[model samples]
Structures are given as C-alpha cells and as structure tokens.
Target: MVALMCAEAVILGTNSKDYQIYSLGDRIFCCAPSTGIERGIMLEISNQVECQYRERGIKPTMDQVRDMLARKYENVSSENVLLVGQDRHGPHIYAMKGIGIPQTLIYAAKGKGRDDIIGYLMHNWKKSLNLAQAEQLVRTCLLVGENDYVNMCVIYKEKETWAKAVPQLEPVAIMAYDTESAFDDMTSMGSNLSN
Candidate 1:
C-alpha cells in the first residue's frame, strides 16, 4: 500500500552542465521527483549521510547515495531518480541519496507505464517551465493516481510567498534557522572562494 501509492518530490541538484559536482557537509543538493514514501526514503538517506559526513568528514557521492538507499529500497537505479536544477549560489539545500558510485543528473524520474510517461510529456510540453520555476509556483498540491493526477505546494526561497505546482506534498514538521547566522557563514565562504 505504502510503496505503490502516488506522490511527488522535487530535488534541485547544482551540477553545472560540465558534470562538475558540488558537495556540502554530508549532503548533496539535487532535485528528483518521488512519491511521499520515496521522499521519506530520501530523508533517511540524508540523515545517514549526515552522520557519516560528521564522523568521516567526507562528502557524499552518487555511490554513497546508493549505499545509503540500497538497504531500504529495491530496484534502485538512476532511471528511477533524477538530480535537477542548478544551485548557482553555493549549496542551498544539502540533500543526497544513494551510496555507491555517482549517479548522473536529471530532474525527476517518472514511474513506468503510460500515465507516468504521458505525464512527463505534459510536464515538458504543456507546462514549459523548468523544474525550478515550476516548483516555485504552487500553493496546495496532491499527487493522485496518474499524469497531472499529482500536485504540490511549497515555501520557495522566501517565507511569505508560497507556490503550488501539480504534485508536491507540503513537508510537515519544518525547521527554521537564524538567517543572519547563515548569512555570516556563507559570506565567509564566499570570501574564501574569492581568495
């Protein structure tokens, strides 16, 4: 029941066209489409990777993403996943999956069969918006059965403004950090990059 139910997930991976990979702490920020359950699996991956990164002080690669996911998921393949978007301003979201070798980049993976395939067609043809922009345009969404049957709601870059798209679930139990503190850290990192 849980495994088969429909859902949607978005991951914005910052792999600048040249296959250059960026990593932060124990997490990698990449966007992929998934169901509610799969999203949970990804969260598990993030948590595990965080611990590993802390102890070993290493960045997670596609293979590491694989290892972290292999235990809880089956039929694990890149075709079933995608790393979307570009994190132009450093690692915005440190989210990672898998734990073996490196997985190439793609935005979201569609499930097998007609509905999924056609849904992708519509997403590409009709919507005409890149994953990032589309993801940022939603309020309330539900991923139902097939093709556009899914929907999404999110709090994009800003707090007051919310966007809704077809097929992303609003995350529960959110966490907030001090923006000023984070800004200071990023400012220092930027200086280091300049040097």
Candidate 2:
C-alpha cells in the first residue's frame, strides 16, 4: 500500500487484497498484511471513528487513532496501519506499527514492494503535482503493468472522499522492423503514449 499528500488531496493506492484500504468519515485507513482478525479490528475502529465524527462533528486526530491502535496492538501486532485525513491542523499522513508511536509523514508505503515504491516516490514526487499527476505517479510506482487493477482512495480537503478500482489497460506487445521509427510512431499525436 502507498499513500501520499498531493496538492489539496491525499491519494492511496494498492494492488493487493490482503492489504485493503477503507474510508472512515474524512479519513482513510489501511492495514498491511490484513487477515480476518486484522480486518475486523480495522472495521471496528473505523466504526468508532465514524461514530465520533457523526456525533461530535470532529475528526479523529492521528494521535487519537494511534492510541486506539495501541489498545488493539495485541490483536494486530504484526500489521501496520497507515492513515490520511484532514483536520483543523490541515491534512496529515501517519504511519503506525504495532505499539510504537505513530510517525507523521508527507508520504508512506508499506507491505510488499514498499521499498521500491517509496524509492520511486522520493525521487519523483513534487509538491506541485496535481491530483492526476499524483495518481499517475502512484499507479506507476505500483508497476501496474503486472496488475490488472489498482484500488485508489482520494481524500480531498473539504470535499467528499472518493474511492475506486482503476482498471489498467493490457500491455501491448509489438515487433517492429525499425525500432527507432516504431518508438517515434508510438510517441506521435494519436498514440496513447503521446501524453
């Protein structure tokens, strides 16, 4: 799983079913290496967070979520949770591992291929990236060529959260007699790669 703060929005991307992401009120939560027990824990916590938001009109802070996770650490000691949300302090990203203190960050990635994804983001991410660019960067980081679908969650500041499964186009295989010309042709105006 990967999550990044881009422009006025936070984007999360994942290609695995074991690490599912969920939207709770204005926040997004995801657990790594999810199992029945971990998923139940996440759902229960999400419900609590949502209820608080609905009844009090206040979003849960990262620290508060960390405390909640800390209490449930025994049940999900091997799993890590990543959260992204907006509050009075503005948008934030947090990473929590077991009973350790949560770390605030501009971006976070975990689970399989996390190192590679984090490396790519560190080199390619920029503060000026728009929503589309950020989503593309995440999709690229996931190496979506190998996966058929990429699940995404976007939390926009002061706006409703959006979540979807983006389908990836099938990789094309081509044999060109003239390699340079073929590359040029693919980069031409009408080609999908032109953009």
Candidate 3:
C-alpha cells in the first residue's frame, strides 16, 4: 500500500507496488506500480486529499512519493503515508481527514473489522486535538484479515509529519526516498516497489 501528502500540489497518487522516488534530471521521476496493493487506495485517497486542499489554498505535489516503507528483502513488504496540507489554522496542523475531509488521510487496519483505521484515527483526534499528540496516541488497534490479524496505524501531526503503517513485517518496505534511492532500489531488485 502507499500514501502521499503535499500541502503543495494537492496530493495526487499513482499507486504502484514497484514505487521508487527517482531523482531524474531537472524533474524527479516517480515510478510506482500502476496497479497492485494500491489498487483502489490511490483513487480514493487522492480524491479525498484533493478535496481537502480545495478552498483552503493548500496544494499538494503531483510528484510526491507514496508508500510507508520500501524494502529489498524478499520477505519484507511495506505500507506508506505522507502529509501535504497544513492545519485549518494554517501551520499548527491537523489531519486532512479529521478536519472535515473524511478520506484525505485514511488509516485502515489490515485485520478484520470495518473501518478500524477510521475509529482509531478518530480516537486520536479527540485525545490530542493536535495530530502530533494524536499520532503519538498509539493503540493496539486490531483488524482480522482472512488469514491474519494485522495491527496497522497511520499517524500524522500535520501535513508533513506522519508515520504510516504499523509493523506487519514493516508493511511493504517503503523505501527509496529520493531519486538516487529509487534508482538503487530498482537496480538492486527490479521488483515492483517504489515511493
């Protein structure tokens, strides 16, 4: 799974398992999966994020990297998230989703249950009143998947500060931050996994 935030160009997404934040020439090249774990996640996440940016003068980058983690280890997977906008008040910060933008910042648990991520995020919202403190408000959130009980999380203090995915084997190994990093990851593995 993958995620991104800009508070710049209005966070958009091109969800792909093989994501690699590439630093090409004048422009950075983003090569992520056109399809994969991020199947529906991208469309839904992006639309919501964009809506949050509207009327707020907040713009997310189209080139921002998505995904929580990237790994070269064959057994490692990853989950990712990023922030893009400021708080309703302009800098202090708040979640894009919590601030009346329901889908902008989604945090769904991988286990069994409906919208566990939503419930978890809402809980944090009330506790901290600030995404920063709210994010730190970690809980042993659980979800029952068909085959496993995954405990996942997505914490964001603002548009720029966030921690994606819990620790289900590190999610998808979201790695390769910059262009160089993406290049190395691609050359090393050649598998589907990027920013």
The C-alpha lDDT values of all candidates are: 0.38, 0.73, 0.32
Model 1: per-residue Cα lDDT over 1-195, one tens digit each: 001001133233211121222222233433333445556666666777788778888656645454455555554543334332222222122223343223342223333342553344345432244444444322111132332433222212222222434567788997898999999999999999999
- Deviation from native of the Cα of residue 185 in model 3, angstroms: 53
Candidate 2 residues lying further than 4 Å off, grouped into runs, are 31-34, 53-58, 159-195
- Model 3 stretches astray by more than 4 angstroms: 1-102, 105-112, 127-139, 142-195
lDDT (Cα) of model 3: 0.32
Model 1 spans > 4 angstroms off: 1-44, 74-119, 122-195
Worst 10 residues of 3 by lDDT: 65-74
Could you tell me the C-alpha RMSD of candidate 3 in Å? 20.9
Reference-based TM-score, model 3: 0.24
- Cα lDDT for residue 161, candidate 1: 25
Report the lDDT tens digits of candidate 3 across residue range 1-195: 222222222221222223322221111122223455433444444554456567565544322212211111123232232233333222211122221221234323221233654465455434214433332332333212332322222322244324455546645776656998778877877555432
Candidate 2 per-residue lDDT over residues 159-191, each given as its tens digit = 432343566889999765898887788678467
Best by TM-score: 2
The candidate scoring highest on lDDT is 2
